[model samples]
Target: MNQNNKVKHPKGLTFLFLSEMWERFGYYLMIGIFTLYLKDVKAGFAMTEAEAADLYGTFIALVFLTPFLGGLIADRYFGYTKSIIIGGLMMGVGYCMMAIHSLPILYLSMTLVIIGNGFFKPNISTLLGNIYSTPEYEDKKDEGYNIFYMGINVGAFICNFFGAALYILLGWGYAFLAAGIGMFLGVGIFLYGMKHYRAFDVKKGMQQGDMSFLKIVMVILFPAVIAGVIGWVVPTQVLGHALIGSPSTDAFIFACIPVIYFYGSLLAKADKSEKRPIAALLTIFAVVILFWAVFKQNGSALNTWADRYTDRHVENPMAAKIFSGLSLSQQLTMAKDSVPLYDEAFRLQKADGKVLQEYNYPTYFKNVAPEKRLAEGTQIEVWATNISQSINPGWVILLTPLIVAFFTWLRKRNQEPTTATKIAFGLLISALSVLVMIGAVYSGGNGAEKVSVFWLMASYGVITIGELFLSPMGLSLVSKLSPVRITSLMMGGWFLATSIGNKLSGVLATLWDTYENKANFFWINFFLLLFSALVAFMLLKWLNGIMREKGIK
Candidate 1:
């Protein structure tokens, strides 16, 4: 585990790190602006909250689903390196296609990106784990994935700034072009590392007693597709609707039924020695879905908080200079004049028992003096809101080193928690981040005033810590516990958990407009996390036994 244990870590690690950094850079840049792009009157699609949330949810849900297919292919035929290259290229192309702005092209582009991600996402992690499986690097495996996660967030953190610059200085097309450029750079970085990882990226080619590729396609993929179609046509709440949040989400949820069943069947049929380990991993995966459902809202509901409720007023003359000079700050007019921000797609009742009326979303600018509206004209200018997406990734880059060192200290003293224990605690901590927002609700007083940016910042900071504990550790846990032959397949299971959570995040975000008191919105998230945390904590003793039986400790 020590640096001195080997001459050095593999060069592939550094190359893959840079590659992932740039890929995430492209991906996050798009996501940071995704909702804002949908809702923009002049430059965006002019969609309402429910519409955008549905699309965003469906987009991310499908994004995670592809890994299910991608992992299968890489495990059998294409191998890891080729799959990564192909996946990266497809995604880069998809990023470029976003510039076209046509809905049909958008769907096609999303399909490409989804398939690309499926092939690319899980394999890279599996590849990194394979590299670390060697004795020289074995002890440092957790640190390796931590560093890798940092690369992802570094890309995520910096991309928003680029997104801001491109959008402000030019237009949406230019910003999307920037994303495409970042994606290509990631591919270049990945290609540079090919020689280093060529040996480890070997194909499994189906071992003895393993299911054949054709059988997986016929029994799993084909059946899942048929079932998804049935789910689409079925007259059920989970389906039977054209809304982004309905039939599509339902179809997706239903599609997962076969895949989920397949994993369970794998366990039912697992050899006696492998049963405990697989069961424990599945247990953790199921519990953590709630965590991701709430956590993934960063790009949706939380993003809305930063855009609307949070007071983005940049005082401190020097701080304004720094942000404004770089085009990263949101500048707004102080005049009493209304800018007519249109967030309300549905009707709302007046507070004083008047008839129902839906109007432009009232802004914090409404709080300014009426006379100031004259000098500012009837409309006001405010800095763009998409830039706030950078906060979480910023926290990640700042905190990863400290967290790793803290855990290292714990390990040395034999005080390290079991992986399951760390995940349980992660769930608990993630729950508290919701409470931070509940405080924001209390402070904002029903949007009569803008909440301070610090509230959102503080919330993201706390949640980032929980994300660190859960996310990378989830990857490490799967690698550590999965049977070697099925590692990538199991990693797909982890992403499957994430896929379901992401879809649910969209479903949750779509409810934002319905909540008359946004504080209750966050309270709902709080309870969801609390429930999941309780479930994990209650099962901890049983989970620990399985971990012990499987020799995971």
Candidate 2:
């Protein structure tokens, strides 16, 4: 290509960015409302917080877990482009099917998404690495990944507003249909750039001694199913109150054992030159689980915090009008006679030791003073709960450029931190973000009152910095360090760690009601990240040494 015609990066990057952007828009839109849908009294399943949290955790965990098989299949049989198209179509159809308001269909829809994500997630990332592998783009690989990461957040940031608008204006079904449309759009965008990625869409066929596809299915998939079944059917009384919080929780943890072993076997069997780097990646993967466990709670525990504890009522008429026009406001009718009573989990607040019978009580006003409360039966508008899902992605959108610029400045000054170092600091910084929530809890009088929405925004801002440091670095590290032949497979391993942490996040959220004092709950999250940070810091020298040996930054 002529110099003027040649792009600074691959033309494929633009296509991949838009494609992934739209895909995430669909995925996040569905996730942003998932728990809310499950817990809605009239329109939803009316599940308790614990029940909803468990299902949400299991759904996200499986969503990330399938990439291992997908990457393996793409590496061995299908190419990246084909797998991406198939996965995208499957997810689109699945999202549409979710519009059917039946429990069986809901589960079936979730299954389709889980399987679809497997085929789509890791391969797209691996393809991006392949495009950047050439000498022309090699030096800019990290920057390329950062830019791509920003695209994901862009989709994530924008989707909630659309989801909120659709849910408010049309209904739940239309909002879900919108997710499906976004996925189909993503697939169309990917196909448009197929020719650009073709040169780099090389598949690694079966290597010598690699297991056959059938054997992998038999050894990994079949055993996982059997183990999950056993975990699910085994009595909670057998273990005395559920071994790991719930049957699904137990099943997922049990299922992961074999997959964890599979990754370990890969390390054990690698040639000497590849062994240490694989080990380093695995070590980092193990530690970062804590970061994800806390971060993923934005969907479950944090969503609850936003719904019941944050001050979401709009006092400014202009702001209310704007939000109303966007279909992002929830109208509450204040009725003193309709106040809800506390459930067993305390999710609903009670008055005068009497259980209230009314449905759709305005629980958001539970903490308000009597003098400030609206007249009985008067209607007031507040922003919807799921809109809070936008905060982290909003931070990502604002701070990513600043973060990239700061690191670039450090690089120019020869003072840039190593990727491993950035991740270590990321863990520590994320731990501190948990402290912001602890402060919020205490400031709000242990959930007895509504706290300022700024607390949630500040917490998200702090954690977004940590996320920028760690998440993209992990992806870049896999690309930089993995054996070229197993790049996609190792990416799968990175996501496997994420999968486990995501499930654990749900497990923790299920316990949200167990803590009478909510500040203690956040303190526990802080300590988990703190411990992980300590471990990462201790291993920093060894990890950097491995990078140096491989001649990478």
Candidate 3:
């Protein structure tokens, strides 16, 4: 092997990077406003917090879940480029359709996104790995992935501002339409670089003894649909208060049963040489589910905290003016007007007499002292709640270079941690980030007052370090550990873990009002991550031994 000071990676990386960035721009833009859209009394479904969180969780989970089937189709029949193109178009149309404002149309739009993501997500990732498979690029694989991951965060970081501006200026429909436009741009970029990735777009086709596509539909798809219907229709009384909180929850879990079994069958059928690596990957996947269950709350639980509990008012006149000009600041008028009185769970508080509607009921000054209240009819400028979603990606952009450098330094000294060790440590670090939220809960007097925005920023900063450690490593791990024949399939398996944990995050968030002491909620998240970390730590030596056996570091 020749070592070169200046390694030239495939030119295709640039195209993939841009395409994925735009795709994520569209996706994150929509997600940044999803719950907000669902909960808006004037323009949205007017759902309660729990209702919105449940639906958000289910939607995102399905978005990730489809990639499993998408990867299979891409690997066997469609090839990466075709699958990606089709998926992008579907998603673009879906985002545009979300502007329709009908409940049935909303569901239809979500379904398109879910299906499109299945075709788009895993295939693009697998295509990148294929480009890096040659001996010349093998050593740079991790670095390539890190660069690619940064592109994702870049898109995620900038999208919220655009979303906020569009929502404020033109309304929700225009904001969603912007998401569609972003997807179309991404598709266009992908097509421009078609020539570069064409060689790597070779389909795996069917292997000897492999299940046929038709068989998969019959055995996996049909069973999953039937199971979902059964779960949805079964009476709660018969099952003892809904197996997992709602009909969709039960249905999704039931549908996943066959999928989980399918992965198990993969392990059962693998050759002896492949068993240990597959088992190791599966074990890691299971442990990481808890990590995502906690981490993914950035969208739901944390978003709620940012909206209702954090002090978002811009005290500085210049900053306020600038943000307001950009349509990134929300103005609340201090005048008597009709407003819904919401309970702890954000449900409309019902009353018999008059149904009193206080102006700006969940007012910014609700927890402020009398001296702090603005004069009547005054319009106070506050930061938009959804802008808080940018913090994590902002942290990612700032920290990725440093993390890469630190790991590179360790590699130079021959002291770099194994991927499993890195992941275990990531979980532990993320667990500690929850402690910051715990502090915020206490400092805010258990949600009786608004806390400083720095607390949220600090927590995101801490968790981002953990994210840089785990997320990219998981992608690289799958590339390194999976058998060549089933690489994309295993990537789908990784995403399945993510999908399950994402749904669990929503479930946990739905229980937000159940805890009177808000600190207990953060505590629950902390313990869950801590438990996962401990399990990962306990298995570290064993996992590392397997990695050594398979010649992966």
Candidate 4:
């Protein structure tokens, strides 16, 4: 390879970027609408806020958890490329199956996605790290991951438009089908670029002292399944109540015990040479759980915020026209007889098993000022609430280059922050984002009024910067520090922490309705992140010392 080409990103980065992009396109599109689909009064399952958030949380938690087995299998049996292909196809089928309305089918579809993502997510990341392992690309590894992160956002940002259009033009099922198509497209792209990464798909089969595959199946997988079943059945059946918030939550937490122990055992049993780096990675993993706990709210609690609390009206006619043309906006009329009525609390009123109230307007108009309210027959165009899910990805697309350039400039001056330091700052910056939401809550008068959409945008912008700093850097850090034989397994550990946090996000979201003073809810989030950032700062010296010992900057 030419020196210039070596210093720049490898050609394989392009294919990986595109492949990950379309994969996220499908995944995020499905996620963006998941709770909404579950709660839709007509076409959906009519789940309550707590019920929807609980299921959403458990679903995503399991989605991240399966990567543990997936990574281990790829490391010991299959190569990265083959695992990625299999995972992609499985997810594609899962997304398409979600189009079916039956609950049993929906559960089956979710199972496919959860299992597929396990195989897909960690290996691709490990492969990217491998490609940068060469001497020339080594120095630019952080930059490579940052650029790859941009590709993820590019797909995430655009998928909502297609989802909104498909759902609005046809129905929810069509929108889901599009997610499957995007996933298949991603798998095809990965296959097309296989030649570029084929050499890097090196699998490190079972090493000395490593448990045999059958032993792992007996020891880890079977125990986890059994424990999970106990967690699910014991609470609701024997105890006659949930020990946790729900059975699924209990089951997930219980299932994780065995997996978490497995990772811990790795640290305990590792050779002395690998100890400190593994310790550092595990420490960082533990701390970043708080970050994901708060950040993953973009799908659940934040989605609810956008749907019911944010004013999404398009005041500009040209923008409205464009949005309408794209099927990204819906027009609502203040017609007396057409809209359903809910109480001041936004709950439906029923008497004798029949809806008793006949309010003449949609629930969205409840918080409008009397003066601002339109005439009875007037129509207003508002963007789809789910479309707000795109804001974080939109900010990522816009700010990634600037963030990359700023870091590059710092690198040239020999003043670039260590990856660990960037992550510490990422936590602190993300904490500030919660304060923004608190401000929104205050501005909205504790949900008594609708707030401007700008608040959501601003919060997402602040957090996107934090995400760019932390998420990709974490991936690079894992790649750099992990032992060659166990790289993918450690990658699985990273996702495990993410899995815990995602579940906690759902747990937090279930409390959304219980808080009368909503700012208090956000305040709790702020404190969690702030504590994590403080802890990260406290450990900086020790973490940096480990990095220096490894001869990495």
Predicted candidate 3 versus true structure: per-residue lDDT over 476-499, tens digit per residue: 799889987777668878998999
- How much RMSD separates candidate 3 from the native structure? 3.3
Clashes of each: 7, 0, 0, 0
Model 4: per-residue Cα lDDT over 280-318, one tens digit each: 999999999999999999999999999889987777989
Model 1 misplacement above 4 A: 1-6, 130-143, 236-245, 325-375, 378-383
Poorest lDDT segment (10 consecutive residues) of candidate 4: 352-361
Q: Cα deviation in Å at residue 552, candidate 4?
A: 3.2
Q: All candidates' TM-scores?
A: 0.88, 0.90, 0.91, 0.90
**Candidate 1 lDDT, tens digit per residue, 386-496?**
678888989988988888789889999999888888888899999999999999888877665676788988999999899888987897789888987677678878988
If the candidates were sorted by their lDDT against the true structure, best first, what order would they fall in?
4, 2, 3, 1
Return the candidate ranking by TM-score, descending. Answer: 3, 2, 4, 1
List, residue by residue over 1-553, the lDDT tens digit for candidate 2: 3542354878899999999999999999999999988877667776777889999999998898899899889988999889999999999999999889999999999999999988998889889999999878887787788789888989998998999889878878888999999999999999999888888888888886567889878877888888887777775647655688888998888888887888899899899999999999999999999999999999999999998899887788888887774534433453345543322123343453223242544356667644555654555667888889999999998998898899989999999999999999999999999999999999988977788999999999999899989998998898899987677668878888999999999999999978999998899999999999999999999999999999998
For this target, which candidate reaches the highest TM-score against the unseen true structure?
Answer: 3
Superposition error at 148 for model 2 (Å): 3.0
Predicted structure 4: clash tally: 0
What's model 2's TM-score?
A: 0.90
